[model samples]
Target: MKKITQELIDRFYDLLSPCRLCPRNCGVDRINGELGNCGAGLEVKVASYHQHFGEEPPLVGRSGSGTIFFSHCNLHCVFCQNYEISQLGQGQRVSLEELAQYMLDLQNSGCHNINLVTPTPWVPQIVSGLKIAQERGLHIPVVYNCGGYEAVSTLKLLDGIIDIYMPDIKYSDDQCAEKYSKVKNYWSVVRSALKEMYYQVGNLKLSRGIAASGLLIRHLVLPNQLAGTKECFKFIAENLSIKIVVNVMAQYYPTFNAHKYPEINRRITLSEYRAAIDILKSYGLDAGFQQTIDTLYRKAIPEWGEWS
Candidate 1:
């Protein structure tokens, strides 16, 4: 029912030949088992799928958001909470038709949207499967939940397809991103990606307490200002819009290989969270959700599983 043409699907699948999907631009032939930075093969591997209520309120609503956690990730962050799935192999391979069925199943369960998590690696397969799902009467908003290290060219292919762009503005500095997330030129790439996403869909628009379509950014406040909340907020306010929905996350903890980096191997201090809030307020980017400082103290350990 949507404008998911065969031509659009072909364009995305062609990227897998040399695999120019993400900014990594590894150019590896993923179809032939050649591994790229994300290490995803041709098939659509899925870690999990369910109605997730832990997401932002608008996405969750009353029925809960449909979450399909994809296998592997382009940005292998040292502090990734979902390291088992994103870094190590923890997903089961599924056919394109099966992938489409997952989407339909979620919709049948009364989900508000299809939240595709860490889906940058398998964009080609996702597009093809989404076409099948769209043709089979799937009519929910498709949420592109990803780390902000996206390629504008690749995202262009998803222009008319994706309804909501919920990406994390992970870092405002390339050095920090490279050191922790193993990404190059992250600062520059994320900015361009964010602009393109905003161009496709404007600020987040809610319909009866549910997100209909738009860009909702998430910025996790890392310990000791590692996330550079000030610069990220400033860029969003000045470039994107002050009306943008930015979920300033406080769910950072030492996990996966995060202990290797002593600077970021600890939970963010209360003062640090407050400082990040101050920066968000200074830019008047207050249209989104903000977690209370005490929320961090409740999580003694990193018990929460976060995709971003």
Candidate 2:
């Protein structure tokens, strides 16, 4: 693998002055401290940093995934669990050097990988930080944890940068996406995004039982929304190879603005989750982990920065 260097990092930072970092195409001049739809500028704002154990097993193996939750999101989903950071913009802005230092600190603390949560809008800035961390001997795999609505061109730039591509295939229908995420063509967009991500990172690759590279697609089963889930899994089975890791998430609870929307106002029932899992099994796509009912109930809520 090609080593991440400071020169590559500098070029990435240069792209952010006129930020076209995400699929939103806000094109706001972030260099002069202007905010776009993501509510972020040249500087990266982080909500918190910790060794997060709440992620999928491989990513959080042994020590835990070194999670750095970035504030604000390109897609403003109504049921966002981390609305305080994503919508309310409650985080402190840090320089690229400072962000890189944080990554090294996490590694020094025995983290498995530097898992960047909701990092679409700040890709360039994060790359810059990763390069800096690399210079300081940060060698752990980098996980690109994002919402599925990503730009193909933006992902192309991240070709040799990211190791593991962990994205949520949120919705498979335009109506559901439009109603919940306010994105008009989210279905097509996410499909294209996932294809590109799969192309970049093939099947899930592990070393010593820890994820080192490849794609791990996540899907949260929502209440009264099996149509989207069925279509999503079908697309995954047909288009992508069956070797890819798929996490059938069953922990959908009413959060953020979900109460305002009647369709998603309640938690997903046991039947709903089981049906999704059954569909996965029926399709002969059995290459990933399925959370137990107890695991879902216990770890659904955020643990407020606790590792393990």
For lDDT, the strongest prediction is: 1
Model 2 lDDT per residue over 1-308, tens place: 24767676666666666776766777778888889988988789999999988888788788999999999998888999899999899899999899999999999999999999999878888888887788789998999999888888788878878889999999888888888887888888899989998998898887887888999989888899733788888889899976667888877788999999888898888888888888887775677767776545666532211111
What overall lDDT goes with each candidate model?
0.89, 0.83
Judged by whole-model lDDT over C-alpha atoms, candidate 2 comes out at: 0.83
Q: Looking at model 1, how many pairs of residues clash? A: 0
> What does the lDDT read for residue 22 in candidate 1?
91
Positional deviation of residue 202's Cα in model 2 after best superposition, in angstroms: 0.7
How high is the lDDT of residue 33 in model 1?
85
Q: Which stretches of candidate 2 lie over 4 Å from their true place?
A: 5-7, 10-18, 300-308
* Candidate topping TM-score: 1
Compute each candidate's TM-score over C-alphas: 0.96, 0.93
